[model samples]
Every structure is written in C-alpha cells, then in structure tokens.
Target: MEVVRIGIIGLGNMGSAHAKYLIENKVKGAVLAAVCDARTERLEWAAREFGNGVARFAGIEEMYASGTIDGVIICTPHYGHPAEAVAAFKHGLHVLTEKPAGVYTKQVREMNEAAAAAGKVFGIMYNQRTQPLYKKLRDLIRQGELGEIRRINWIITLWYRSQSYYDSGGWRATWAGEGGGVLINQSPHQLDLWQWVTGMMPKRLRAFCAFGKHRDIEVENEVTAYAEYENGATGVFITSACETPGTNRLEVVGDLGRMVIENDKLTFYRLRQSETEFNRTYKGGFGEPEVWKIDIPVEGQRGQHHLITQDWVNGILHGTPLIAPGEEGLKGLTLSNAMLLSAWTDEWAELPLDEDRFYGLLRQKIEASGAAKTTEEKTLDTTGSY
Candidate 1:
C-alpha cells in the first residue's frame, strides 16, 4: 500500500487525540479510515468530528470485518491492549500499541507470539525514544565513551496526578483496571527509556511501593526501586505522585565519566583517565582522577506520539525500522511488574519474572476490586505532561 489507512480503537482522551491529529493531516502517508469504541457517544463524536469519510464501528471485530484499514492502533485501556493487538494481527493487519504492552507479561507474551507468527509489523508507542537527548545518551554509551557503567540513578517524579484525575475515569488507578498507578500509567515511557538508553535490564530488583499514598486509589503512587544489572552495576529509581515539586533527573556513572540530564540540559563529567585504572596505578593515596565538566549539546525537536505513528506507517509501507518494537516492550513491562511484585511480596523479584505467579496475584486483585467508582469525567490538557 502506498498510503496506510489506519484505524484507531478506543476513542478516549488518547484515542481522540490520535484521531484529531490524523484528521488534521499531521501525519504524512497516513489517514484515519476507521474508528471503534463501545460507547455510542464516542462514536458520535468521531462521526461528527471526522465526517462521513471515517468508518465507525462498535467493536474491534467489526472494525476488522469492515476491512477499511490496513493497520490498527490500539489505544484502549491497559487490559484491552494485548487482546486487541492479537485480534489485529490475526486479521493480518499491522499494529501500533500505546505503551506498557499490557497489564501483565504473560498476556503480553501471547500477543507478541501472535505478532511474530503473523509476520506483521508490530510497534509500541515508546515515543520518548525519539527524543534527541536520549538518542545522544544511547549513542554515547554504545560508543563506549562513558566506559564501563558503574551506577545509574533516575528521579522521575514529575508525574503528579490529583485525586480528581483518578476519579475522572473509572479505571484510573485500580489494580484490575489500570494495572498499577504511576509505574503503569505515567512512567512507562521513562521505564522504557531507562532500559533503552542504558541497553541493560536488571537481573533482580527490590521495590517499595506505597498504594494510595497520595490519592485515594488502590495501586502504587510512590515507589523506590533498587536494581542490580548482570554486569554488577547497580541502579536506583524513585517516582511518586505530586508529593513535592516533581523532579526529572537521570544520572549515569561510568569508570571514565558521568552523564546527567536535568532541566532539559545534558551535562557530562569526563575523567582524564578511567577511575578504575587511576585507582590501580596512582601512587597518591587521596588524589582522584581529574574531571572536566562539559555541556553536551542535543538538537532537534522531540518526536513524540505523532512521530511514532508516522514511523509505524512508514514501517508497514517501506520497511522502515520501528523506534519501539512490540517484542522488546516486555523488558520495561518486566521491570514495572517486578517492582509491583516485589512490593506485594516484600521480597526481591528476579528477572524473567514469575509470569504465572504475577498473573495469579493480578487475578486476585481484579476479583477483589468490587466495582470501579468514577466521578465527573474531564480530559486534562496533556500537552506538556510528556
């Protein structure tokens, strides 16, 4: 197909935004051909806003049956992600899922298997990976400019959601609905970028998660996690609600230097020699390796969701490499799931996480969540939040 006809499921805040972008001709080589939502009001909105050119369906199956779209973008809730993607793949359609893959790894694994078997292009909306600063960081590490990584720390607590925000949706912050709180809803991109930029996944992790710590919700709002990589390097991740003025800072320490990203600025502290070699050869007992503080330049605009969507279309039509492959999304989901699992069990969770156990525990939570209580709905302007 020269141009990809894209259908978006779940016409909520994000789904609506995607529709508007496409209708406004924001993404090149892509058109909003179809849309699906169980809610009649949402379908009406789509019809009114997008006009008669866009086909509207009550469910994903009907949308697929219509055969109006060459690809599908799943923007449903946390749980519907995997199921919808698998359905799209079964119909031999390309898919681009939002993030977190799904509520749990077991289901996401099945979805990935289906995508692999279908041989269709599967992409995940890890939009932050398109940021120039993160791309630069990944390049620096991959080029061995930072030498051996020794430590990493990220304080990404800018995801402050009020109780009203949670109350706006029935599935805002529930174990059964949205999976977890901050980690699942707000920090998925950061968690994905953590592994994406570093190119490392923790071998094991211990996390302390506080449920309803800031809001009247059932999932985590505050978390402090410690991770140990296979290379013996350690890292710490701290995230929370709007407890204080949130901070977004990432620091990576290596034997030769350290890189810090904060306030939209990138700084590097380079050592004249590797700390390991200096320590081994220096005669002085108290001297340290000479350090130079240099400002790293990162250029270009951050290609957020729109960029990923365009790339997904490009990948399907022209064999372009996806910025976020659906298969690799499991790594970040594993980290998030491991954190919740560790907090729930009060123990460290190992990598290649116990899928069955996690799924079982999640099922229990779903059963226990009696009925979701929703308040007056409001879609906050999510312009600068990302």
Candidate 2:
C-alpha cells in the first residue's frame, strides 16, 4: 500500500514515454511494475529496457490477472481507452488514462460509471491543467474577475502532422482506429481547457471540418467550429495541420474586460467600468469603456505528464484530488463529437448529443474503412509538444 505498483498498457509512443518516466523514478510513490502490448517487438523493447524486474504481458487481461500492479495507465489507442480502463476498474485497480477518454462519449460514460461504482481513483492525463497560467486563468473566471463571459476564441493550429506521421500507423487518422483527427488527438487538451477555464458548455455548435485537407487521412485535419453558450456567449475554435508555423492563442472577453494567453504570457485589459453598464449609460454614441492593459503575473513552474502521474499516485495513496478527474473528460469529448456531427449533418448540433446517431455514423465509417494501411513505425521525442 505504500508504493503503488503501476502497469502501462500499450507500449507505443505515449506508453513507452510513461514507462521511461516511471523507470527513471520521476514520480514519487509510484513504481513501474509491469507493461503490456500486443506487439511482440514492443514487448521485446520493454524487456530490453526494464530487464527482468518488470513483468511483461501480451495484453490488458493478462496484465490485470497477473495481479502485480495496483494501478494501470491506459495509453492504448483511442478505442481501447474505455474498455481497458473499465476492465481495470472491474478488477479493482486504479486507472489513469490518457486524454480524450475515448473516441466517443457513450463508452467514456460507461467507463466513468464503472470507475464511480468501484470507488477507486480514476484520473485522466489532462496534464495541461497543471500549468500555472491555465490554472490562474480558470481561477480568474471562477472568481468572477472577468464578469459574465461574452466570447471565447482559441486559434490552436500547432498540431502539424506530416503524411508520414499518418502513414506510420494503420490507426493514425482512420475513423475506425483513431476516431477523428485534430479534434480527438491534438486538441483534447485545448478542448478540455476551453470548457474548464470558461466554466461553460456550448448549447449548440456548427462546424466546417475539412477532411484530409492537408494530409491524406480519412478524418478531419482542419476545422472551424462556432459554438453558442447557454448564457449567450459565443466561441470559435480553429485548428489545422502543420501547414505553416502554428499559433496557439486564446482570448476570452467578458463584461468587465478581456484576458489573453499567448507566448507563455497572460495579459488582461481591465475596463474601468463594466462594458455593458457603460454601453447602457454612456451618452456618447461611439465612446466605450476605458481599458487598462495589464500583464497578469503567473509565477510558478508548469508540471507536465510526470506531475500528472505523480498526482495520480498521490490521489491513490494520500487521497489527494486529481488534476483531471476521468468524469470531466466527457465535456471536451462532447464538444469534439458535436463538431464532427455538425460537420457531417451540415447543421448546428445541440448539446447532450445524439449518441445513437453518432455511433451509427462512426460504425459506418469503420465498416467502410475496409483494410487498415500502415507504414514504418516512428516514435518522435515529444518534448514541448505536450
């Protein structure tokens, strides 16, 4: 009970990274006890890396039944996340899954339900939540410093993947294997943070998703989604392939003022008076509220993947709250799903999405996918990409 023995499922790019971090003793109160991967080559790599001290399994079931690990970190594909986490929960093991939760909300909902029923620590790898700047942004909104939000715009096109990147894996960009493109893979963190920091969910959304716009993939590579919040606030989410030097910028405007986070800097333009009140009372037709541009100080080190793992381990052993609870993952997935649905149906998709319709359409894509295409397996050093 002192040290939580952790097993990593799927020794792919992300799984191997987690394994290396644990092997290096980066996370306190956590030890790398086991690993699982269907690929024999990956299993051989694990054996070579960790030697005989770490147990190797062919799959999740074998690893779970081995009973060597107190927790499992599911880093499998988009589809495998929910099922593997649910199985881990059923076997009474804590789970810390990588982001997006799963391809869709239904399966993720089922996994969350099982985690709740099991009464075990369930966390998602929303590592960005550990960033001090985002934490401060969420706090500012929650504390009503920005007043009622009016608009949210995030231009996050930093996810530039090449054709070879998609070709490297059979499941890379295919709907049946990886679910969707940019929205599901590269944008999960931003999607989660968008709703997380704003403290608001869209009531409806319309999206224009360009499938294979930049890459030769089946899923969307470029997307422009317009969302309407319940409180009349609107949002625009724009993302694309690595066509140019990408940009990551987020701007939130409210009654009191506006806040922007870009280039690791948080700036706030505080209005002397509420914009709404000024508009209502001002006698001048064109005058607006006076504004003060202030740079909000975010002074702290930003924790990434390893810190999230540490927190997950801490949550299990010390009852510390998780940075990203598994249940909250559904919110971001909902937005992704809604955007895809809107693009497919050519209409504004509403909240509490039609799960059945989405599932049916997804199944159709899977069936039509026919044979999976794969290229040379390449694992890049994902340093600042996270």
Candidate 3:
C-alpha cells in the first residue's frame, strides 16, 4: 500500500490536534480516515468540521469493523489506551497510543503482548523523543561522552494547568478518569525523556505527592520523586501542573562532565579529566578538574505529533523503524507508577514493580474515589516487558 489509513479514537485536545494535521496532508504518507469518540457532540463536531472527508464512529468496535482504517491512534483517557490498542491489534490493526501507555503496567503489558502477537507496528506518542536536543543527550550518554552517569535531576513543572482546566471535563483530574494528574498527563514527555536519555529505569524510588495541592482534584497535582539506579546513580524528578512561570531544567552529572538543558539550549561543563580520575590522581588537595563551558549545538526541528504519525505509517507501509516504539513506553510508565505507588504506600517502590500489588492499590484508589474501571477486567492478570 502506498499510504496508511489512520483512525483517531478520542476527539479531545490531542486527538483533535492529530486529526487536523493528518487531514491537512501534513503527514506525507498518512491520512485521517476516521475519527471516534464516546460523545455524540464530538462526532457531530467532526462531521461539521471534516464533512465526508473523514468517517466518524462513536466507539472503537464499529470503527474497527468498518475496515476503513489500517491503524488506530488511541488518544482516549489513560485507561482506554491499552484496552483500545489491544482490541485494535486483535482486529489486525496497527496501534499508535498516546503516552502513559495505560493507567498501570499490567494493562500496558497486555497491550504490548497483543501487538507482538499480531506482528503489527506499535508506536506511542512520545513525540518528545523526536527533539534533537534530547536525541543529542541520548547520543552523548550512550557514546560514553558523559562517562558513567552519576545523577539526573529534572525540574519540569512548566505544564501549569489551572482549576478551570481540570474542571472542564469530568474525567480531567479524577482518579477514575484520567488516572494521575501531571505525571500521567503533562509530565509523561519529560518522564519518557528522562529515562530515554539515560537509557535506564530507576532501581528503586521514593516519592512524595500532593493530591489536590493546587487544583481541586483528587489525583496528585504536585510530585517530588527520588530514584536510585542499579549502577549507584541517583535521580530526582520534580513536576507539577499548578505553578506559574515554572521551570523546565534537566541536569545530568557523570564522571566526565555535567550537562544542562533549559530554554531549548543544551550546555555542557566539560572536564579536562574524568571527575573520578581527577579525584584519584590529584596531588593538590584543593584543586579540581578544569572545566570548560560549552554550548552544545542541537540541530534539527521537532517533527512533533504528526512526525510520529508519519513514522508509524512508514513503519507499517515501508518497514521503517519506530522512533518511539510502543514497548519502550513501559520504562517511563514504570517510573510514574512507582512514584505513585511510593506515595500511596509511603515507602520506596522497587523496580520491576509488583504489578499485582500496584494494581490492587490502584483499584483501591478507584474504589475510594468511587470511579469505575475502564479495562476489560478488574484483575491484574497480564504481563510483558520492554
């Protein structure tokens, strides 16, 4: 096939945004064949906006059976992501899901397994991975330019949302609806980038989350999470959707030097010698390794959401590799889950999270909040890996 037919489920903010570009011919080899939503008004809106150019469905089952789309983009709420993707895959459709893959790993793992079984192209909307700045950061770390990483700290509270934003939708900030607040929504990109650049998940984590701290919502609105890596490296992730003029700073320290990314520019403090080597060989007690401040040139513009859609389409049609493969979504999602689990249990959550326990706790939260589960089953009975 020369082109891929893509259907978008969920006519919310991000979903509508994707529909616009795909219909506008922004993606070279992909077209928005159809759109789905649970709300009738959204379907009517789509009809009014796109006319006969795009099909509309009020649910996924009909859209899946309609045979109009080769793939589906799951942009519904967090819980709907995995279930809808799994269904799509079972119907022999490729899947590109929005981030935080699912409310929990157990469900996402199931979705991953379904995609694997179907042998279909699986992609996630981790559009941040397309940023050259982050791409360069990953290269430097992977190439050992930064040596063995020692620490990672990101103050990514730039996605500030007001109470009105949360109040706009019933599912906006509810525990039963959107899952978690900033961690599940606004901060998923940063979380994905945090682990993507470092190429490792935290060995264990302890987190403090402030529920309804800023917004009048039940889920966490502010979070401070600390993590320890298996290689003795440590990381701190701080995020919130309640701060104005917030900061987006990422600092990574390694044996060779320090790198900072803020204001879309990357800066590196290159050390003459490895910090460990200097510490080992220094004859002068008070002397330190000489540092050179360099502004690392980050090239290329962000391809953003449409680029990811095009890439996924290319993967389906031309055997191209996915920039944000759906499976890799588990790493950042694990971080988000562990942080929430830590806060909920008031303890350090370990890597390879106890999926059953986390699911049980999450179910408890939904019960306490009186929110119903959106997945097919109430039990955490699925498993897979990155």
lDDT of 1 at 367: 69
On lDDT, the leading prediction is: 2
Each prediction's total of clashing residue pairs, residues at least 3 apart in sequence or on different chains, is 0, 1, 0
TM-score of 1: 0.95
Superposed by TM-score, candidate 3 places the C-alpha of residue 20 at a distance from the truth, in angstroms, of 0.9
**For model 1, what is the alpha-carbon lDDT of residue 180?**
78
The TM-score of predicted model 3 comes to 0.94
Give a tens-digit lDDT track for model 2, residues 1-386: 89999998878778889999999999999999998877788889989999999999875677888889999988876776777788888899999999879888888899889999999999999999999999999999999999999999999999889999888766678876677889999999999999999889999999999998857789899999999988999999999985679999999999999999999999999999998899889997788899999999998768579989999999999998888998999999999999999999999999989988988887777777633521111121111111
Runs of candidate 3 exceeding 4 Å displacement: 370-386
Q: Give a tens-digit lDDT track for model 1, residues 128-204.
A: 99899999999999999899898999999998888898887666688756777899889998899888888999999
Query: Candidate 1: which pairs clash?
Result: none
The local lDDT score (0 to 100) that residue 132 gets in candidate 1 is 91
**How accurate locally is residue 144 in candidate 2, as Cα lDDT from 0 to 100?**
92
